[model samples]
Structures are given as structure tokens and as C-alpha cells.
Target: MQNQWLVAYTSPKTEKKIYGRLLELDIDAFLPLQKVTRQWSDRKKVVEVPLFPNYLFVKITQQERWKVLSQRGVIKFLSHGGVPCSVPENQVRAIKDLICEQEVEIYGSSSLCKGERVVIVKGPLMGFEGFLTEKKGKMRLVVRLSSISQSISIEICESHVEKIYG
Candidate 1:
């Protein structure tokens, strides 16, 4: 394959299951994960967990895509023209870098929901680099700091958040 990454859009919330299945099926797959440690209000506890909830990256030959499609939790490859599309290597590498540096732990769906990058302006959280998400009928701007891999998401009002690059 000319590309190293393919997007595996799995059944919702079945990301981990698919990751394990892919490995079991001997497919070189990676479900990009961010370790997060969240504590309950009355507890001094934390847990490491994944950031992206339902996506995984797979390294497969074009010929082996059918094998991937046969996996139980896999839905379909991200595609165009009815042919599976390869995810850009740099994008996959960026995900790897985030995982390697542990930068992804604090970053959540809201942080990178609008493609891969964004610029932030307005609010007390100004100058904080982050991403946006449209959820529950609102636009959320989130900044995830590595301190706890904890993200602060606020419903964005009238603000200046623009994509610098995608």
C-alpha cells in the first residue's frame, strides 16, 4: 500500500472491542487513545482512558481491506468513489505523536472535532490553543491541558475561532 493508514469507522462505542479484534485477527491496527484520569467529587481517585471514542487506524494492504470489513465491530472504511480512502500519513503521524507525547490524554472529541486544528479567541481561556464541537445544540470550545488530561469545555457564544489549517 502507498499509504500507511486507513480510517476504520467502527460501531459506536465499540472502539476498544474493534482494536482487540483487529489485533486478534492479526491486522496492524491502532485505535488512537488518550489516557485520562478523572476523579469523582468525593473521591481522590483517577483513571487513565482513551480520548477518541469510536475511531481506529489500521495498516492494511488494499487487498486485505475485505478481511477488515469482515471483522464484527468494523463498519466501513472512510471512502470516496466507493473505494476506501487512505488517511494522510501526516495526520496519522500527528495522532501517533500525540499518543507518544501523552498530549492526547487531555485532548477530547471537542478538541479536534472540527477537523484537526483551530485558533482560539475570547473568554477567560483566551490564548489557550484548542478545538470545537457541536453538541447538544451548541458549539463547544474546549481546551485540554495535560495537568490531568482534564478538559474544560464551554459552549461558545459569539467568538472568533477559526481554522488555521486542516
Candidate 2:
């Protein structure tokens, strides 16, 4: 079977470690991270933290699924009704492109109600598709990563995106 992107749930705080292991084993993986300024009692430091906690995306064929599961930190692939869920390539590409911008926010998939489907037609996010939402009186584009029940929202200009009509 051809390789497909699957979401791997990992042990808490082990995302980076498991990602490294996947890399060492020559398995293709993606772990989205964002740089944030963390405050400590003594000092402040900027660190790169996983955008989606406890989740990593792996590209593998059906036969390779077991190999991924054999890794120490991996719990299992995200699934529905005992069947592994594969993520669309376009969504993955949209995420990679979305992270290049600085104002992204992560949200639990359940928190936001579905809104209008839209595709960015201008600016850096051109061609990225997501739902249009309004929060705190500002419009944002929300990209839902359904396999893992998480979504990422980025504030966007209304002119930058157009509604996707049926």
C-alpha cells in the first residue's frame, strides 16, 4: 500500500523524544512546534513547544504501522471504531504553511462550532482552506485537524479569504 499520514499518540511530554526516534529509524514524521516565551520565577526563556501536545504525524504504509507501534513512546494511532484514521495531504501542507506565520492559536476541536468553509486567496496563506470564525470580534481562519480532535486558528483579514461555496 502507498504511504499515508497517520496520527500517533505518544506518552506525555515525550513528543520530541519519540520524534527523534522516528527520525533515527528512517520513518517520516512531523511534529509541529511553536516558539513561546516561557516565564519562570527566576528568568524568562523562549522555548519551542509542540503545537499539539502528545501527538505526532507519521507517514507509513499499512505494513509499517506495526513498526511505529513498536516504538517505546508511541501509544497507538488515532482511530475511529478501531480503524486508524489517515489525514489528508492538503491539511498537512496547510499546517506546514500556517506555522510560518506568527499569530496561530491551538484549540480543542469541540470548542468551536462549525462555520463557513473558506480558502485563503491572498497573502502568505494563499490556497490554505479552513473554516471562518469570529472570536473576540476579530475574524480568524480555523483549520481543523479532525483525526486528532484539534484545530489551529490564525487571525486573518476578510479580504485575504473567500468563502468556499458548494
Candidate 3:
């Protein structure tokens, strides 16, 4: 079977640990990390934390699924109707690209601003769809995939996107 990107649910606060275990087993995995400041009694410290809590992405074939599940921290594959669902390559790539962006923001579905649907007409993320939200005179494209329950906002040129009607 061909290799596909699958989402793996892990134990609480075990995303980084599971990512490491997958790597040791020669499995390709991704754990998106973002920088945030944490407050303490004495001082505040900046740290890199998992962008998606308790979730990790892994690239593996059908034959390799069991190997990943057998790992200590992994709970199970995210499945629908008793079958593992594969994430589209474009969506996965978009997430990776978002992580590398300097002017990027991540938000849960509840907080996304309302706007017209749009697609990137040009640039590396061409064809990505999401609600367009503007803040402080800066235009951004917010991409939300309901299946993932997470949204990403990336700064884009106003001319590079066009409104799309449903």
C-alpha cells in the first residue's frame, strides 16, 4: 500500500514524546510547534509548544500502521467508519508552510472571524480556501479545515486572492 499521512491521537501531553518514538522507529512524523510565553510565579519564559495538543501526524503505509500503534504513547489512529482517513497532501503541505511563516497565527474554529470565502490566486499557497480576515490594516487568509478542528492565518497580498462564491 502507498504511504499516506494519517493523524494519530496521543496521550495527554505526549505529542512530543510520541514524535520522538516514531522517529526512532524510522516513521515520518510531524508535530507542529509554536512559540509562546508562559507565566510563572517569578518570571515569564518563552517556550516552544505543540501547536495541536495531543495530536501528531505520521506518514506510513498500511503495513506500518501497526508498528506505529504499538508504540508506547500512541493511542490510536483517527478513523471514520472503522477506516483510517487520510489527509490530503495539499492540506498537510499548507500546514507545514504555515509553520514556517513569520506572520502566522493559529486559532481554534470558534474564534475565526467572519468574511467572504477566498482562494489564493497566486503564490506558493495557491488554491488554499478560507475566510478572509483583516486586522490592524493587514489582510490575512484564514484556512480552516473542519476535520482538523484548527485554523491557520497567513499574511498575504491583497492582490493575490480573489473572492469565491459558494
Each candidate's lDDT (Cα)? Answer: 0.62, 0.81, 0.78
Candidate 1 lDDT tens digits, 1-166: 5435777777887888878888998888877665556678877555534465556778888888888888888888776777766765654554464456411122333434543456656434444566766566455656674322345454444334555563
Between candidates 1 and 2, which one is better according to lDDT?
A: 2
Q: Write the per-residue lDDT of candidate 3 for residues 1-166, one digit (tens) a residue.
A: 7899998988888898889888998899999888889999999999988887888999999999999899888888888888887888777886787678654332324433348787777655678787877777555787776556677667766666677866
Q: Please, what is the TM-score per model?
A: 0.56, 0.77, 0.79
Output the better candidate (2/3) by lDDT.
Answer: 2
Native-referenced Cα lDDT, model 1: 0.62
Residue 61 in candidate 1, Cα distance off native in Å: 1.1
TM-score, predicted candidate 1 vs. hidden true structure: 0.56
> Looking at candidate 1, what is the lDDT of residue 147?
25
After the best TM-score superposition of candidate 3, give how far the Cα of residue 41 lies from its true spot, in angstroms.
2.6
As a TM-score, model 2 comes out at: 0.77
Worst 10 residues of 1 by lDDT: 102-111
Which parts of model 3 have CA positions greater than 4 angstroms off? Answer: 104-114, 133-140, 146-149, 154-160
lDDT of each residue in 93-113, candidate 2, tens digit only: 767766786544324344333
Ordered from best to worst lDDT, the candidate numbers read 2, 3, 1
Instruction: Report RMSD (Å) for each prediction in the order shown.
Output: 9.9, 5.7, 5.0
Candidate 3 local lDDT, residue 118: 79
Query: Candidate 3: worst 10 consecutive residues by lDDT?
Result: 104-113
